[model samples]
Target chain A: MARLFKPRMLALAVLAALASRAHAEPAAAPARAEVLHWWTSGGESAAARTLADAFRAAGGTWIDTAVAGSEQARAVAVSRVAGGNPPTAALFNASRQFRDLVDQGQLTALDDVARQGGWDRVMPPAILDAVRVNGHVYAAPVDIHMTAWIWYSKAAFKKAGIAAEPRSVEELFQALDRLRAAGLIPLAHGGQPWQDSIVFRAVLASVGGRDLYLRVFRDRDPRAIESPEFRQVLLTFRRLHGYVDAGSPGRHWNDATGLLVAGRAGVQIMGDWVRAEFSAARQRAGVDYGCLPGLGEHAPYVIQADAFVFPKNRDAATARTQALLATTVTSPAVQVSFSSRKGSLPVRSDVELPSPDPCVALAAALMRDRARQLPNDEMFLTPDQAGAMADVLTAYWNRDMPVETVQKKVVAALRDDL
Target chain B: MRATWAARAALVPVALTALLGYLGSTLWTAQMSVTASRTLPSDHFVGMAQYVRLFSNERWLLSLDNLLLYGVLFISACLLAGSVLAILVDREIAARGWLRQIFLYPYAMSFIATGAVWQWILNPTDGIQAVGRALGFSAFRFDWIVDPDRVLLTIVIATAWQASGFVMAILLAGLSGVDPDLWRAARIDGIPTWRVYTSIVLPQLGYAFATALVLLLTGVVKLYDAVVAMTQGGPGTASEVPTKFIMDHLYGRANLGLASAGAIVLLVTVLALLAPFLYARTRAAASIA
Candidate 1:
């Protein structure tokens, strides 16, 4: 009886020690941060690690609560704030996504950090407009992504006997025709609505030029939407549908990128994030693939960005950590490293990038020219209006809806907008 | 008299839960439906404009139609399959425990994983269609998962696979309670086993079937996971359902007003449909007593 009791007492003592050690350090806990973001993929995780490393180096304890999808991440953040257990900072798109949170006084402003970082002068106008609400900056811009970049396979182009990149919409179509004639799928497109809209925007800007694109989306001008020029752009977008493969519907964007990686497809109109896919397959930019920003003159470069907004917290440690995170994220050195891993351009134009990334170099050069800078659909339209318009466009793309009907539908969708 | 006090004490929890959890949420949802709430709840009332928008939206209309189709097919298939499996188990088959576990495997899986597996199996290029073609049947086509007209049927198949197992388990519980004397009496009357099951057994299991049907109906109403995992309400909103529409509006679309309106509509429709059935249940029990 004595022998058995002694061993049980020993086990109980071990458990007590473990429990006490776990509970001993609550008062001494460092500037603790619980960041919530949707960066679960391998490359995305690597990019996030850059930020985590920066935060840790600044004497903050990093706690990552990475959710996989953007909507799920935002939902978790919303529930946390509403339940009075908010995270230190939450990732939001550099759009009006967090406008509701700001309006409800659920987000902490970063005016001090923004002023110190000189964000107004360094950040581009479209990005500045996204992060600033009223008079104060509410979020820190991390990286800038250009949607609707034309990515093409160099091997596929060579096989199709095309010598150079297409300079105009007509040339691009002719190149697609050549790829088709060479017995290849000319467009490696995923049939989801967002991807569909990306392809449509690419055509809208590159084909119809910048002003026409803005009038339809930014101004929500009904007359421009129903105009002959916009109709022509719509028809051009329809023509690309013929070049896509039959099994394109319900395919993931990565699988569509796989087609280009394998050189079985010619062109994929996608965001700069596809560069990560190319890199994953060990494909170089200029040698293995090529990126076209837009059709030469009068082209508009649409920008999208990712940022982190702090949940409203008066805790001294949380405030300190949030300020540190803002500085780390916006710093030129960290932005360069994070953006490189993220497969996008740095938000600051002054950030030095390696020359190997020809695509980002081109985007940065276009970024310097304010005339070519355009906001993506998310930057201008609210998420609801954007989703509604995307539904109509996706339906029109998949179904046999007439262009005139689509024009009318766009008008109806924007009828209630401010 | 003391036992009466104890019984009354037990009613307090039920009463509070019904008032605060159920009734409170329903009222909140109804209020929000009238207001132009976006992302967060607001007091800016816009009357029935949200409902007006909901009715006019083509996507919402498609969602309702899809839900109706999916509900009918999923319920019928699950009941038919469950009844058949329950009968097989009731016959005292060999290795009954193993068979029961195997049949219940899909019910234990999360719908997200099962939906993904079904998506892979039904995907035209890499799934069964490709395998069939590779085996020299070049004309094979199993593209219903992508086709707008037939996508909902594929959802029915995937959901039925997950739900029928659960129905079978419930019916088996009911089957176990059948008095063995009834079988002996039927045998003495020279009644066939199948006829005995159809006539004597099925009628007794009515309550179990009703329970399973109610559970399955709730699942059909909140059919977000299977649709999102399998097709994401694509290709071009082909397989959209009411819950998915509400979720998209609530989160991705940031239109809480429209989503709340949709939720209220769904809840009212379900309650209205269940009212008669519930009334009949209570009346039948009263008559029996």
Candidate 2:
């Protein structure tokens, strides 16, 4: 009891000292931005560090609070704002996340920065629309990620007697069968909800075509969901489930990529971030692994962007920090450098990528075609609806649930979202 | 008066802490639950709408069901295993101190590391399956973590392994405080060992059992880290718990309205389960007085 009591007393004393000393760092005159973000992974950390380094170099002190996952970092930021201790700026995805923040008057408007930078001319309209809440910019776009990309192991393909990339879904499945016949796991799936949705969206685009994809996810049309086109998409999504191994359930996304890296798996339907894992393994791109934008020639390229939002702060010093952050995150040189390490395309349309990763170049080329651009579910639907739809999709994929039943649940979830 | 002043000063910190940390957060969460908050809290009031959604969510409902199953199994297993281990250790066994340390060591390590180790150990391809095949047990299968129906059981097993030691330590302390004279008298009366234990010794452990139960119950209510680190509430959310459900919406889903409702529901559930027992204890105490 004495030992426990003594430690508790010490802890209390230390906490009391810290509590009194909170936010009393001799308020610097220049903008001192405290940024909370989820870029703690090696590549992501490097990307964030470059941004911070630039911010510091440009007459500011960059205080970085690094958390691991996007979900966790966002939660901390939101809670901090509620608790009346909001950070200067925090990283957020380019989705509907900032809508609620803006509704609560928690985020500061960045219209001044947008005008100063002439963001209207450079940033894509879709990208601009995602950040703008009621005709005002709430976030600064950092990087863009293309979600519907298929990564394959060259060694696994060679072993399976696949000479080149498959242009269509039929040939893709045929290649998967050949890989499985060669005694390799065909689809390296993580089995998490997000990864499951990614593969489903891939199939929806490649098999069901672009209009049907948009109608089901974006429009949430009941007829579209019940149509034969959507049913084929669901069937194709479920068909890929057969190629995945039993151990794929509840597996981490990185571990699934590990199978590909080890040549134990043939293909992974993942985002551009898989390139980071391949690079980390010291494997040269195009030699060790190959990336396909979509299964077919004219498939829509699904895209998601990561961005940062500045929460509204009354303090002048904190406001200055927010303005600096908005300016620093969107600078062209910073965008290209940060996106290069992150395996994502820069949000700015004009910036040229330096990395010669054939996969990234193909994605860049596809991204240039405005007609091929597709929004992820989050870009169109509320986070709640997307999550609910993901739950239904995962349940359908995991079990032998009837497609008709899934369609009903999808409609029900969308109705609930309203 | 001076002593009283010192006592009041000592309690000032605790009172302030309880008010600011516990009560304040509770009120804040309760207030937020009634509002139409989403990714962030809004001032607009939308009474019970979030609760309606919470109840409608299949994952939240499944998590609530899993929590009940996990709570029952985990608390019972820990209590039984702890009591048995305490009794065994209390005997004139060789190297008793070493054995006690071995049993209690798991409690010293964080559950994050332990959960990962257990996940690897229970994984089919890399763990027991490989070893089983290596040992010529070709037909052996120990992949409970991947089996949807059996995944919760795996969580229970892993959690019980890490927690039973703490229970053993508590029960051992209680067992040591038992009157040695009672045991000597029982032996002289020629009473059977099993009977002596069940009738006399077990009854003396009621207070210790209560303490262990409360500790384990608290653990059951907040069982997020182990489940996350091990299964991530998956194999299709089979091992999902209410705390994980609340946390997922609180952050990942960015649906605080639903998260707040889940938190309130969880709190009410814990209070409802604990109230009757607490009331009974108070009544018993009053009657004895």
Candidate 3:
């Protein structure tokens, strides 16, 4: 009995020592950050890892909590924040997606970081406006994705005998006609509502012009929506629906991109992310494929951005970690590495690309012209309003809704009361 | 008295769970429905405005219509197919266990898997239509999955295929419980087999049928996964259901008030439909007691 008691006493002493060590470890430990994002795809995960590696290199511990879909990730982040166990940082669209978080004071303002980093002069105005709310920088803009780009398979275009890229809305239709005549699918379109909205925005920006597009989306003026020019934009948008094959409905966007990759389809109106798909297929842009930022010379460049917002925390250590992440994300070097891997334009245009892809070069060139820059609909409208407008557009795209009726529906969808 | 007190004490945790876990959250949701809550729940009351908006919203209305259409078609088809399969298996065919396994297999798989398989099978380019065209039928057209008008039908086909097997399992258990003497009497009376099933056998399985109906009705109300997996309520929100709408509003759209309102309406609808059935079931139980 004395021998057993002696062993137990020694065990207790050891356990107490371990517990004390655990209690003392937090003070001198590195800044630990848990970042939640939705970059689960192959290329996306690689891009996300660059930021994580950079943060680790900056003397912080990076913990990745990747949820697959953006909506699911944001849902998890919002719930965690509301439940009072928020991550250090969470990814969100550089839009009105996180406005509620800001309004509720659930996010820590990164004003000091922004000031130190000179975010005001470096970040694009559209992205800056999105991340800055109530004169406080609440998010770090990582990359700018031009959402409305016309991606055409060079093989399909050659087969269709189209010589030059369409310079105007009329010429675009003529190219579609040629592609259709070649017996290939004229358009590789996914019939999802968001994809439909991408096509609609492309038409609105290229056909309706910048002023009309702003009036319709930004100003939400009913007069602009009811105008003849907007009607023509709607008509062009709907007419493109005819070029999509019957198999288009319920198809995933990646599958649509796969059609272009295999040269079974001519053109796909999608974001710059499609370049990643092309790259994965070993297709070189401007040789195997071509990306048109917009159809005409002066077409508006519709841009959306992915950003990271730091959730509010009272701990100074956690705040330091958040600041480290914000700075690392927007730093010129990390931005180039991340955006290059992700096939997106770096948020800071002041940074030169080491070796930009042709599509990125074009986007970079277009980015230099501030007047050509336009924010995507998500930037101008709330998520709910944007979803409502998407529903209207998708219904019109699938069904034969009259353009006049659709215009009224669009007006109603964008109402302030809604 | 001590035993009774112990029994009551044993029920305390369950009581607390029901009160707090279920009732508390439901009350919270109801409170949120009347407020102008967006991404977060706020106390700013709007007083039935969300319900008003929900009723007027075209997507919500269309979702309701789709749910009703899908529910009726799915429930009826499941019942009919299940009853027929049960009768077929009740005849004591050889390899009955294997037959039962084959029929019950789909029910064991998740709705997500079932929906995905059916999505591919119904796809126009490389699915059954393509197969048919390959087999010398050039004019074959089975593109309902992509057609806005017929997309919902594809969902019905996939989900009904998944659920009918479950109904069969339940009804088969009931079929086994029917007294052998009744079958002997039907056979002795020169009654046709089909008549025996429709008239005598089915009427006696009323309890089992009610149980299956309740389960299937609840499944219908919670019809989200299959729709999400197959059509994503797409081809232009053509196959959208109430549950999917509420989920989208709750998370993606960040309209908590509207989502809560939709949830409450869905709950009320389910309760209204099930109340009479439950009343009758309790009455029948009380009469037996």
Candidate 4:
């Protein structure tokens, strides 16, 4: 009996040893993390590579899964999570995009990492608010992007005989006329829904002024959407459509930038990401191209941030890797380096920016003014409402729909469950 | 006794697959459609509100309308084009084998790349319009892709180009299966060529035509990639279809309840149209047997 018991005890001992070894952290294994993002564009790719390099330097593995468009990438990530296999981290625009993820308990709360890194003191309130969910940090914001920038080719402006940037809506229209007469596309436009919405928001901020813009988009007030002020903004947005080339429909943002690069188009109202396109074409900022945040000095600068969210998982190794990724993404060096290349500003206002391209530096400076900073519509409205608004805006731009009809439609859409 | 258990064992995989994958998912989706699900399926039931919203949505209504148009046009065109191609190939046409290969080649390429290529060819700037202007025919305008009123027509043309080959292949198989004796008998009867084709050949090819129609119908319902790649349902949602609308709500807008309701509506619509046709076919087969 004693001999039989001895053999059984030996078998149990061996099984315990194997179990401990399976779980015991291998002191030498690198923390491998796979990141999914839409930074596959040439410049965005390089910016992502900067983060990869920093992560590598800190002794971690970086796996990239880049999808071209942000919406496409996010969709793939969400599907992956639903399929029970999610990436270590995924890139998301700083908005209400991850609200569903948090609500479903799919995101790992990054509050511990946020506290450890002193994120509250570094990041601006707006940016922090964008990444926070229910008093917990659910994402690590990487860069801040100003979406309402007017980009123009300096050479085209010179040929058009416009000496300086237009300070008013009327002057801007006159400049467009001069550009048109000079045999260039008055506005380099991509007639995609998002692109049309970006122009509409810029017009909203510049013409409708910030309060009305906020009331309609942020507050989603039906009265504000129905007001004459919103109608005027819509009309101005529609008027700009006339300046666009016939080929604007289905054109890519890069193609629009290409028109500016080749001096075929005079101006483009686009996000600061256009700066990367100019840089890629070997055009110098302030020399070959120029930027205007808005027509007026007090025009609110619309801000959108790109963030990384870690998926919740039970695996200890995966959780540890996620925590590490959250820390690395918000590291000051990574933030500065990524923003410098990405044509966006750093999320943390306290971080000293590296010498960015001239356009990025200007955007960074503009971000410094508190009054100029305004969260993008996604930051306020739910993704559903934002998509509905985009549909309305694009439809109005494409068709000769009456302004009153558009106003009524806008009000009706906003009046749906907020 | 041995055969009974073995047969029952063989049935297990199909049972498991249908129960877990198909029926399970359908039930889950139907449940979620009742709730105000966003991003993920939620248990918060909101009754028939999502269906109400789906019916009220302008884009959704337009998508349904476009799907109907696209369905009728795409299927009929594919059938006609495929039959014509098959008939020509079966005749004493020169280089018949090479022609068959050429017609079938487009199916090998991804629709994403094909759609982009088609977009360029249809664009007003550098496409048919530019070529027309270059040839001194300035009045010629083939920019149906950009014109909102005619964008869906361009999609139809591009989709037909990709799909007609598949239809042709199916019809060609049916054509080959035709007994040579029938043609010889028709020749001896002094029947006209068109009469032989219309009365004899076409009636025999009914099964092939039915198969093509059903396949094309499925393709029409699942038509999302081409629309996304070509126009992205744009020109102010003029070309939006039900599948793309459901997809937009599914992930982009994070409104799964609305998306599910839309899917259920689409499924029910397809079932309503297809059920009687399928039942009639089955009944005819049983009666013939």
Model 2 chain A: weakest 10-residue lDDT segment is A1-10
After superposition, the stretches of candidate 1 with alpha carbons farther than 4 Å from their true spots are: A1-33, A56-61, A316-321, B1-15, B88-92, B172-208
**What is the C-alpha lDDT profile of model 3 across A38-62, one tens digit per residue?**
7878778899999999998999877
Clashing residue pairs for model 4: none
Q: What is the lDDT of residue A79 in candidate 3?
A: 75
Off by over 4 Å in 2: A1-27, A115-118, A315-325, A416-418, B1-9, B185-192
Better of 2 and 4 by DockQ: 4
Candidate 4 has what TM-score?
0.91
Please provide, for model 1 over A1-418, each residue's C-alpha lDDT reduced to its tens digit, 9 standing for 90 to 100.
0000011121233343344334323323547777878887888899999999988887787777776567666766775676566778888889888888899998889999988998888888888888888988899989888888899999999999999899998899999999999998999998888889999999888878889988988899999999999999888888888898867876778889999999999999988888888989999988899999988866887888888999877566677778988988889988888887888788887777876377777787888887788888787788888889898888777776789998988887766632
* lDDT, candidate 2, B1-289, per-residue tens: 9999999999998999999998898888888888877777666798888888788888888988999999999998898888788887878468778878999998889777898899899988888987998899999999888888899888889889888888999988898899989989999999997788778997899988888988899899988888877877777667878887777676667777778888989999889878877998999999999
- Residues B59-108, candidate 4, lDDT per residue (tens digit)? 89989899989888888888888888888787846878887898888877
How many Å off is the CA of B268 in candidate 3?
0.2
Error of 1 at A414 (Å): 2.7
- Which 10-residue window of candidate 4 chain B scores lowest in summed lDDT? B87-96
- Candidate 2 vs candidate 3: the TM-score winner is 3
Residue pairs in clash, model 1: none
Candidates ranked by TM-score: 3, 2, 4, 1
For each candidate, report its DockQ versus the true two-chain complex. Answer: 0.41, 0.45, 0.49, 0.46
- For each candidate in the order shown, give its overall lDDT on alpha carbons: 0.84, 0.82, 0.87, 0.83
